[model samples]
Target: MLRRNFIAARDLEAELEQWQERIDIIRHKLKFIRQLPGVACIEQLNPPGTAGGRIPALVEIAGGTAIASEENGLLFPPDIVILMLPGKSIEESLREIGSLLEQPWFAESPALKNNRIYVTDCREYFQLPGPGMIDSLEILAEIINAGDFHFGFEGLGWIKFESGSPKNG
Candidate 1:
């Protein structure tokens, strides 16, 4: 009985269709990355007032090299940095983002030096295993790919990190 229910829940046909769509999108995205070298990115977060640390496996499916891994390996400076914030509230999240940007080490990181740091709500985008994964992939592709793409916050659940300014939720 359990096996039968599990099989039903699998929704094999829908899963296959989704997989096919993802493959097609990947093929299309790969064209743009063909001439470009792989980008190095790191996922991290700064809580209210402490030093920031790496977020594990956040970018594994994002098609870039993740400088921070779960093994506590030496971190390499990244080309792109994604900062995830705890979803306390919009105002608190913004404050934490500002705190992170103000850190001297953060300013010195390669991502910040190159203005590649992006801020997002961790819960909606990174904390859960859900359909948001697709949006996360798309967001990473837009940032890493060579194109004039700007990060937005409607359905993507993310926004560009701009220091000294508050992002209206």
Candidate 2:
């Protein structure tokens, strides 16, 4: 049976309201590229050198669709590639990703050709199901509509592949 929902505190309402405000701001910044054209995102947790992985739920929340693993062989090209690694520092993760990018398949993928690769720390962002989910949504929104927004990644825990370093603004 489906469980009923409950609101335990007034502060929860306030927190939600704050999240909504942040979402609205992000949505506004992403209005131009609301939906990535032919976007296909994959989330690999604790990648190559490590173990454990899962689909990223934030894709839908960020307004993009997630390509099922079963269909990996069917797509001609995906417009985006997202690497979600928990616990690893940005440098280590990037090194792993750089190797992956060198593979024939990944090198030819449209996501790389168009420079749409992104990386993030799952521990600080998308690993679990929680209220903090909104942060990942916002980060993806910012990344997807990057061209339109021309903004920095400062506080966001995610990074675009091309930037090579975290943004301070």
Candidate 3:
């Protein structure tokens, strides 16, 4: 009986891993998501001694004129990385927008976490133009799972969301 339980547990873990990979693929295929323009991607260098706060990378919005101050990083949950942009991306503009936006956090976090790219992708929309976006960090903290991911925008740049449950957007 104990042996059977062990096998079951191992299989469950494997299944979860497969699900995570599948979710990652789906996220990558998102036409709107991959093309988001991150203004800046701030990287939190893991030093020998320092109290790590949040957001490993900082971003600057392209054409949006938004900047991320360290104070803003403190506002988010430690686990989440926020991607900020000054403006929103229409489906037609996704490709161009993705090119304009930077993604330092997106690049660095995956390496830090052994290529768990999608999880890093679903950070904050830092410079998004909304009072609610800033205030929403706490709420995002609850909804974002350890391995899930998402993004959203609003107003001129108010879009936003989080990632979870391997499904199409």
Most lDDT-accurate candidate: 2
Note the residue pairs that clash in candidate 1: none
Rank the models by TM-score, top first.
2, 1, 3
* Cα error of candidate 2 at position 109, Å: 1.7
TM-score of 2: 0.66
All candidates: CA RMSD in angstroms? 6.5, 6.9, 16.9
Error of 3 at 106 (Å): 5.1
Give the per-residue Cα lDDT of candidate 1 at 53: 28
Give the runs in model 1 whose Cα sits over 4 Å from its true position: 1-12, 31-60, 69-74, 86-91, 146-156, 164-169
When sorted by lDDT, best at the front, the candidate numbers are 2, 1, 3
| lDDT, candidate 3, at 74 | 27
Worst 10 residues of 2 by lDDT: 45-54
TM-score of each model, in listed order: 0.60, 0.66, 0.24
Cα lDDT of all candidates, in order? 0.49, 0.57, 0.29
**How do the residues 24-52 of candidate 2 rate in per-residue lDDT, one tens digit apiece?**
77656546654554344434432222222
Error of 3 at 39 (Å): 14
Q: In candidate 1, what are the lDDT values of residues 1-169, reduced to their tens digit?
A: 4554464556867876785576457546565543332233323333212112233232433445555433332145456655555543334465656555654455555566656666556566644444455555556655555253334543355555654433232
